[model samples]
Target: MSFLLGHFNYLIVVFLMMGGLWITFSSRNYIKRMIGLALFQTSVGLFYISLGKVAGGTAAIVLDKTSKAGEALNAHLSPDYVARAGVDGVVYSNPLPHVLILTAIVVGVATLAVGLAIAVRVREAYGTVEAGEIAELDRTEAGPRA
Candidate 1:
């Protein structure tokens, strides 16, 4: 298990995505479907975060001048040691995915709110939120199609 442990986040991502998909597809209630869509959106965000992570990585903060000076002193002591240290320098995880995910989350919430609002309107108009019932009502109201 080290490999399994290392990649566990991906498994959770898949589970969440699949669960969301199931709810969205199988639920008769529009609200439940919207909740599933939100769940799916969350899973997508998690997936992006997981993919953007770097093992043993830190934030992409710039090193201060003092730290750079200390590193220079250490480098002069031993070239080989400095070479190794340089190779193992602070690894930074990518920030773009996290930023994009933040934007996506805002968009997802807005979309969910709009969807719920529409669902509310639909319920008011049709007296129910079940898609099948709404379709039946529509058919009855429309009569036979030529």
Candidate 2:
């Protein structure tokens, strides 16, 4: 069940990415294009999140779990205890992906805002929000200008 859940998360990310790509290419409306851009950015975020997660492993911070009530806890947790725990003395999961995702999220929002702004401008100038109309108007204008 857990494996499926893990894979499902990544699969959904891929699905979202493909949906966004399809929308981005298939839409004629500026708004729809912007929606697709936003979806694509969100999908990328999902990808990063999916890549960063570690199954069954807690965050890397060593939470002073050493018990003070008994010396046995200290004895067991000595250097030997770390060696027995397994590879590299700790199963520390890489956090770089998480950090990068945080930055990417901020950048994604900015990109969406910029895209929407351009879409609004396109709609204003062309008197229509459709990509087809905007392209048509641009072509007509260019034909005369040249």
Q: What overall lDDT goes with each candidate model?
A: 0.79, 0.69
Best by TM-score: 1
Give the alpha carbon lDDT tens digit for every residue of 1-146 in model 1: 99999889999999999999999999999999999999999999999999988654445564432476445544434545434443344345678898999999998999999999999988888888899988897878742232
Off by over 4 Å in 2: 1-6, 60-62, 67-93, 139-146
Alpha carbon lDDT at 71, candidate 2: 33
Candidate 2 worst ten-residue window by lDDT: 65-74
**Model 1 worst lDDT run, 10 consecutive residues:** 81-90
TM-score of every candidate: 0.76, 0.69
RMSD of each: 6.0, 5.8
Per-prediction tally of clashes: 0, 0
Q: How close is candidate 2 to the true structure, as a TM-score?
A: 0.69
Clashes in predicted model 2: 0
Model 2 residue 52 lDDT score: 70
